[model samples]
Target: MGSERNEHPYGSLKDGDKISDKHKRELGRVRSSPTFRLGTLFTKSVEKPWRLLWLPFSILLLLVQVVKERVGATPRYSNSEPFTGESEQRNCVVFFPTNGVGLGHFTRLLSIARRMNKADPDMEVVFFTTSPTLHLLREEGFAAYHLPGRKEFSNMEASTWNSITEEMLSNVFAIHRPKAFLFDGSYPYRGMLNAIVRRDDILRIWVRRGTFKKNAPNVPIDSFDIFDYLIHPGDSVEPNIDEDETNNSIIHCDPVVLLDDEDIVASDVLKSRLGIPEDEIVAYIQLGAGNINDISSDISIILGVLHDAGVWAVMGESLLGSRIEISELPNVRILRDYPNSRYFSSFDFGVISGGYNSFHEAIMFSLPCICIPNSKTGMDDQFARAKVAEDAGFMLVEENVTRPRMKNLVSKIIDPENRQSMVESGNSLRKPNGASQIADHIARLIFRD
Candidate 1:
């Protein structure tokens, strides 16, 4: 645990006492006497002339410390490798994503970074995160740093945690000296803000997906001013709530999916890999990580329906959660792949939650899906997003899901003609992958400038 290593007297101060315990009683009486009070007042009167002289000196020392930090002073962390900008590599970009209930924020930033790298092979990409999934980023061949979440600390103040965040991130910036820094999350941390406060050399960007509920608590308005660019990943449905237009230039792009059309695994290849016969009817079920709400009952009901219908079911296990316990059956299987959308085309149809990434991915891939929106989220209006797809004949929405409703929907979706109609609607409404477009924009802003 970091507790032993980070043990500091942050909350253990005792009025700056230095007197020995043995002499404390006599000292206390002398301090409390009227003579002591008179002496203190006399001393203060005598020191008044020198107060102005010492105050300026103290303020000057504080100013010097602030200036040192603002000017990219040496990082305080032992592992820091400060960037000297003398290496052959340049055009670096750093991505910072907060660990959400699932992989929403992390996947979005990873998608953009992938496209950017594909476009500019020499562009250096890095990651700094509090998410526990550092292994996945390393698997993708990206350099990443990790900071444990504030909850990991025992009885530490939020301010202290943020100070740690600031130091760690500042060290990363010192090492990479990125040309641009992108953050993908709803709320930006104070530590993150402080880390980049004086880094005018880099372009600050915010990649915030939009679909927040009207009454939900949102990111602070002034926080938007800190970024030079804000990219709003478009939603399927236009939100009914009025959006404030006063923030930094908001770059509205189409839904950002991780994989492009060519990137999707061939249906035959995917099916063969999963050991499914070519003739079997397969359904893919992917609720979220089951962190914010219980999804076990829902999964059980869907599995039962599929089993009854003789449909081979493959459940997507979230990387953030422990393995789900499922009753072993010949037709049921579990997939632990990150970016499950690569195999979306292999499924006959899907039963998925209405998250921004998965919802748009199902549409982008033309996979006729049943959108079982998770409405327990703090801000996402999943029902609204699903309803838009439903209205457009892209898919069906099951808000209060049950066996009968799921079975009926499954029966209708399995019909060849109905499935084709849904596929056509999706194909007709599909936008070009927004991840590549955003990558192009980033290139133009950083490389071309």
Candidate 2:
């Protein structure tokens, strides 16, 4: 029967013989397969060793990966603080009121710096400014450095002027190794300016008094990079252009006015001393400290207009040198060297041109101003800032103004309804207590330790 024929391994019998010859051969092969059993046992034994090794190895790899990720994911903090130990030294310094220009920028910067110094005694603030501003700072009992500036006004070509200014900057930076430098204008001498800043490893800051959209047309915005930080002196007025139009480096701090509690007290005293009646409207006319020749004509026109409205003029320092005599006008008061703070509150209204001090102080006092922008005298920024103010309902009078136009504008501004509207608008726009905010920002920047 096929040798007891083996049903094929464990299956039922097939058709004819219950198991064919092929089935018999398969059963014999199975009975003889010790080699296959040995091979199966060998493969299983090999897999067991690999599995034992892989479990511990995979666990070790996972632990290493986790530790690596933990180390790699740590956050980075800025090491802005100067060295404190024997190996290194730490210093903080600021540059304000750059030489050979308007006192307004210098005065405003000085005011902010003074506030900062009062708050923190440890900081070192170096003022690299004109001799006149430095003298004023010295009188205030602040340490200041004076850079020798050219007093003569000769129009030199741009290339020649640039070289001269660069040399001047090199000399200034060599004397003062400041860690941080602050310049007032939007456009400064970039070649010399950047060289000094870069060489000293200083973090350069630019105090942009106002927006770039208004300044870009007149100032060289394309030539220089946007400042590391820009301090706008007014309430955050939206720029006229898209955000993409400006370089993204600027950090806009609050507009800074130098007036504080002492200044306010002094202003009150001056108001009382000047016999400026609290009830009557008093207008301060500040044409600025520089360039009386270009703005004098407009000043006469504005004065004539204010005189007609029965508004008193508290003329700024520029009036002292003006050829046009205001001595004849009984209502107008020539404010020669009055404490700036005291004179500020003496006015119910402010009719001034663009200067950092007058603009900010007027806002600080909540006084409505009819801004007559005077550009011919190196103040190209006045018109642009005036435009922003005008859009917000402040009155605007252009330079080289005529008597009739000035009179008409002043008459309208003095009108009860007009004056009320302007006052309300000014109050809405004024961020009265910004000095503390500015001080805090500066403190944090200077003292991160």
Candidate 3:
């Protein structure tokens, strides 16, 4: 199907023309015309000066269009009523996928938003998120509205969190005036869902990921009735979507990841940026932030094991000193950025969490990984994902990677035979990232495609 989409050349070639019948016909005879081709090339070469003269003007026009779009300059009625007749042109798909944890939800939403923009640049694909990592979106030239999110849930009460969530949504929606609101999370907080239910003009779309641990008692699926549609991003390559096949509101999609292999930072670039020597074998140890999983005590053990094995260790600053004090280890380096997965190619292998983003990136990048699922998370579905990775032989696991266990596993994992199998298994994944599917569906609704 992807090959067909590529061959068809309509969607893939956004903002550019594809091979038409005229082009095919021209190529047939043009191949025989060396002199005519030469003349045409000569004429085009002579016209370069004129083209150059107009280049600045072209750029200026494009810049004006972009600025106009960015400011929401078009005049429209602000009446508390739905658009009817010909004035119902949708300009944006406001996304609310921010989380207090890692950048998984934001990155996944970004992947889709970017795709949507590529398809229709006029459509203002905006982010109404609570993520403090707005700089990440800004760097990519995306407009995002900040929401006051509680980073730590240690002392937060349910009622308090609900109120905060509701107020955040209400404030953001009033400002952006979005035609559609895409909520990407396991449970849509009562406040946001209630807001969506009360609005007739707004199209509520739920972007939920599945393969949630069976033991994890989630909110009843009936609550999802408030959404007009549910985009369920599957966990496995060939996941059995039949279990919830009767849910008419759900549109199943492939697993979503921020970056594919091509987006990986070059090994040399990564090494230079991180100040690591070219020849050193690196293991990126990320057990996730303390809010997700508290593997503080085990960080020292993993680092010690890697150090003894003559391997360098790299970790996110959030992971270092989470559980306990981190000493000045010469071999351990801290990554201080969001979506650290982009630099995944720089490392030789990984010690990571079994969350969706981590698991997807490990396989997507073909990294030899030892995955540790967070058993304490009530809403997390890491164990199921870890089982998939284990069956594929792409991942090694431990309930709690103790000092002794890590030391033994290191030797077994780094063995040439097992490492080769792990790498091969990672490379065997055929599932797409499903970003385009999300973008396309929303684009159809937004642009009436």
The clash count for each model shown is 0, 3, 1
lDDT winner between candidates 2 and 3: 3
Please give, for residues 1-449, the per-residue lDDT of candidate 3 as tens digits: 11001122112211121223224323433542434434544466467866656565655664565455334342111112222212232455688885735566777888888777777665566787766667777887888877555545677776577666665565555445566788887655655654455455777787877666666454534446667787887675344334453344777787888776677777887788778899988888778766755566777788889989988888866522343355578888877665677888788789888877778878877788888887776566677778878887888888777888898889877776888888998776647778888878876665453
Q: Spell out the clash pairs found in candidate 2.
A: 232-255, 233-255, 267-342
Q: Tens digits of per-residue lDDT for model 1 on 195-222?
A: 6654556789989877888877755444
lDDT head-to-head 1 vs 3, winner: 1
- In candidate 2, stretches whose alpha carbon ends up further than 4 angstroms from where it belongs are 1-90, 99-101, 150-177, 190-197, 210-248, 266-268, 275-280, 290-293, 319-326, 338-341, 377-381, 394-400, 432-438
Worst 10 residues of 3 by lDDT: 1-10
Which of the two candidates, 1 or 2, achieves a greater TM-score against the reference? 1
* Top candidate (TM-score): 1
Where model 3 places Cα greater than 4 Å from the true spot, the runs are: 1-89, 150-171, 220-222, 237-248, 319-326
lDDT of model 3 at position 171 = 50
Top lDDT prediction, candidate number: 1
Q: Please identify model 1 stretches exceeding 4 Å from their true place.
A: 1-89, 239-247
lDDT of 1: 0.76
RMSD of 1: 12.2
